[model samples]
Target chain A: MNEGAPAGAELLEVRGLSKFFGDVAAVERVSLDLARAETLGVVGESGSGKTTLARCILRAIDPDAGSVRFNSANGWTSLHSLKEKELVPLRREMQMIFQDPFSSLNPRMTVQQILEEPLLIHGERKRGKRVAAVREMLSRVQLGADALTRYPHAFSGGQRQRIGIARALMLRPSLVVCDESVSALDVSVQAQIINLLEDLQAELGLTYLFVAHDLAVVRHICDRVLVMHRGRVVETGTVEDVFERPRQDYTRLLLSAIPSPDPDVPLKPLDRATLNL
Target chain B: MTAPVLAIRDLAVEFKTDTGVTPALSGVSFDVPRGQVTAIVGESGSGKSVTANCVMRLVQPPGRITGGSIRFAPDAGDAFDVVKLADRDPRLYDLRGGHISMVFQEPMTALSPVHDIGGQVAEAILCHRDIGKEAARAEAAQMLERVGLDDMERRMGMYPFEFSGGMRQRVVIAMALVCHPEVLICDEPTTALDVTIQAEILTLIRSLQHELGNSVIFITHDLGVVAQIADHVVVMYQGRVLEIGTVRQVLKQPLHPYTRGLLQAIPGVVPPGERLATIASVVGDADIETPHPLVALADGRQVSLPPAQLRRVARS
Candidate 1:
């Protein structure tokens, strides 16, 4: 480990990450790291194992092999080997934002209930403090305190996403994995959520593992981006470096596929240089 | 002179929720030339999907096309008034998947799980165009083949679950095109798809549009897709037209702030070592109560009044 690295260095690290379902390899040899207060973007097509990587990181599903090392307030711990009970403290330090805001949230629970559940489960604070914390978080996400009474269905896709963010930030986790958090949102609303995430990150010193299929959104928000293909990290670079000087064929193809606003301007023809990486 | 393939004049759509009348679209106007791709691009709730649904007469209850005329110009001198026809009219049914067809987002729900792949496409062909079951099967196979599917015979008998998302979308496209409709409306057809598959589907749509000479209305939030396929572009915002122009004009040199923001947000444009531009502020950027006229930029392109200028009172 680099000695001069920040105290929150390597908030989460994946080494040789691999998962398989029957004959299909869902994720293979995928390695990435999330630094403290840094945003790491994971981009890929469906079946590219971006979600599986997220699951493995969150331990929502156990990986077949590999290690996930997380440096929390309690020091570094390997997440892959930890059982549910052993992982509880670590879970509190890391949270995930799901893709579909409508479906991921419980229909029965009010927004306040949803936000407070994690704090309650961790026994981090008393019920009264939890309510105050929930209200504060809601405010941070630009939601009203009165919204606490309403269920997720009452909110629009973008608003619901804000609630999701509020819930993720409730515990003051070392890292947050936003898995397609804005995919369901409209373009304008997506921008709002992206901006909110950025602001919260700055204010809270929160780190993000922003997973999404939309390269454009990833480009805007992510400090560093990893492009996954068929369950492996195919390309890794800063947003500008990876997008502008894509070193892989799949990356080039993805870049070319983005719907251009200019109908007359065909995608810049791919030269042989882009294929070698 | 030949009539325009699709003409919507002063179109207004509204949905009656418990909250009251929520206007979804108002005075949205445009025309799609035959054999061309006309893209309706916007953020969510921009009424792009609503407009497409209106074309199919598929807007569920609680939503109504309150006003507007939709005229469809078929081949030669043939023309049908779309808005005048009631949803129950046989002509609407005939037009759907016959004269005009649609490919929707989320093929899992769009395709029937109960029916086999072959049965579904065959049913579409047999429904409007009088054809035998065996003949329909052959045509379905051909359609699947045209959509770049291999081993059509075996795949046809399989249910939707067996196919991958991209393949299923292709099947949906095939179903839409099996009858050679005069118009194809794709509502975020590739949104659920992965990037590479999206590329393939986009390529397929572009090629098919060229080969079949069928007009297409592509409704998507993705500006890249509009750039790739659309000749004409229509940008919508909060139930009204924000801007309409050629794809080149709308995308490369976007006049509308929303459009420009969207384009700048794309990851591909960010130079190495630079952070992407994220537009901050409220969800609804446009003036909801009034029709915000798009102004002509210095470059002779159209742009909606920027959110800053339009929201001066709110900002203050």
Candidate 2:
């Protein structure tokens, strides 16, 4: 069945997706589309199911129902129900970068080992050329060649993240989900990483699902934005549309909750009038 | 402006590394007026924590303040210089927690892992005041209650691990205030907590500041937290003060380019795939060549800057 676009037009799609933990629905009837080479940001507070949805898409955790489909060079395929053998090769088509750079990268492994491990497991790149590929990826991420010999501990928090991004891109995945990638970094380092990601996306034709709680960071990077509250998508629109004119009351509250750089601007007093208690 | 209870002038800190000396703080000067809540905002490695540690004389080995004077106004009219005091002086110990307490970033590591939560809170009270175990326990419970811990008595006996992230922070707050210190230094106290919990904690700190009328030095990267709590803001970079002004002035009409860039870097409250506004250059990368060591403003106050050759100076 031909959808709104051609067979390989859309990069990824989630239709009526829901994840249930016992009796409660973690994600309820969620649907979204990510076009090829687009950066989509997902904004939400903790426990908003943004992470759960990312897990469901990555198939790190299976979704209880609905479908996660990917459009690739071969054809469009549903990822939600794929068995291990079937999904093995397709796993290369998508990858994820976690929030904490410390835990995400193996401390014991040298940067060389960490970079090579993914290419080895994915198997698209030949084993004989893996070293060269590893070095290439390192340089692409703006890291020096000398970094190949260093351990994770030797690098600062920002440098560790560049390595993390390099590791995720080693598979040549079509999509990367950066879940709070810069939240742990200091401000200057965060800016460096953001610029690196932007440059990489332009060069590599990569699409990103940028999930973070920091509104200013989201403002700087995402092309389109969505706001999640509790377990639902309270507001969804282009970054300009949502920030300029948020429709939902909850969206407004979340925006207001964001602290502005102007210290003189009075904090949106927590609406004591609105608190149920 | 109210007279500063804690006045620091020409403050500088140096760490003796194997390669020589690394100047972490240089000519850092500021005033924390009594009854005011001031925020020292900067990125990581900007020496925000070092400034806090210097004030407490908790600078570890190889790290020492080679220069500067930290004056604490005498309650009865005289003043004492903090840097001149010995590291282990009884007076320094006496001032700590009793006159100036601190709450660190991570509550999990800050609290004793083996001790019951109540024991830790009571210990802080016992250190500053002459009190028996029963009296300390009662004070601990009451302190916990003041910091918004419900069922405070029951929670006291529980270990730190058993408490939620927010509750553990509350316990730390209780411990800090157990002695009713005149000034409080909170170094990213809510960094580990969720937004809703952070909101609650910010609200609590504001209320406590109002009630006690003590000065506060809040060190954090989150401008939102700064907005919610700070009466004045200190923007620091590379261990030096970049901009110091009223919170409104810094946020609304930032003078230093670094300050402006920092304000621009906050993510807009929306989802991704949108055009996010970003500051063009990183903080440490910018270079400004100005002849004057300190620029004089219309008010006759001079703002300090690093050397002209140094690339870290903030532009106009």
Highest lDDT model number: 1
Top TM-score: which candidate number? Answer: 1
Per-residue alpha-carbon lDDT of candidate 2 for residues A16-64, written as tens digits (9 for 90 to 100): 8889998888887788889888888888877788989888888889988
Q: What tens digits encode model 1's per-residue C-alpha lDDT throughout A1-277?
A: 1222334346777788889999889999887777788889998878789998998889999999887888867677777677788888878888998888888899999998999999989986677899889989999999998899999888899898998888888999878889999888766577667778888888999899989988777887889999888888888988879988988898887787666555666755343244643
By DockQ, who's the top model here? 1
TM-scores across all candidates?
0.87, 0.85
lDDT of 1 by residue, B1-316 (tens): 4567899877888899988999898887888877789999887778998988888787788999899888887775567778889768888888888888999999999899999999999999999887799999999999999998888768989999999999999999999999999999999998888776787788899899899999999998888788888988888877888777787778776655666667776545655334446533221464444566555444444445656673542233
- TM-score on B-chain, cand. 1: 0.89
Q: Chain A TM-score of each model, in the order shown?
A: 0.92, 0.93
Q: DockQ of each model against the real complex?
A: 0.48, 0.40
CA-only RMSD, every prediction: 4.7, 4.3
Minimal lDDT window, size 10, model 2 chain A: A1-10
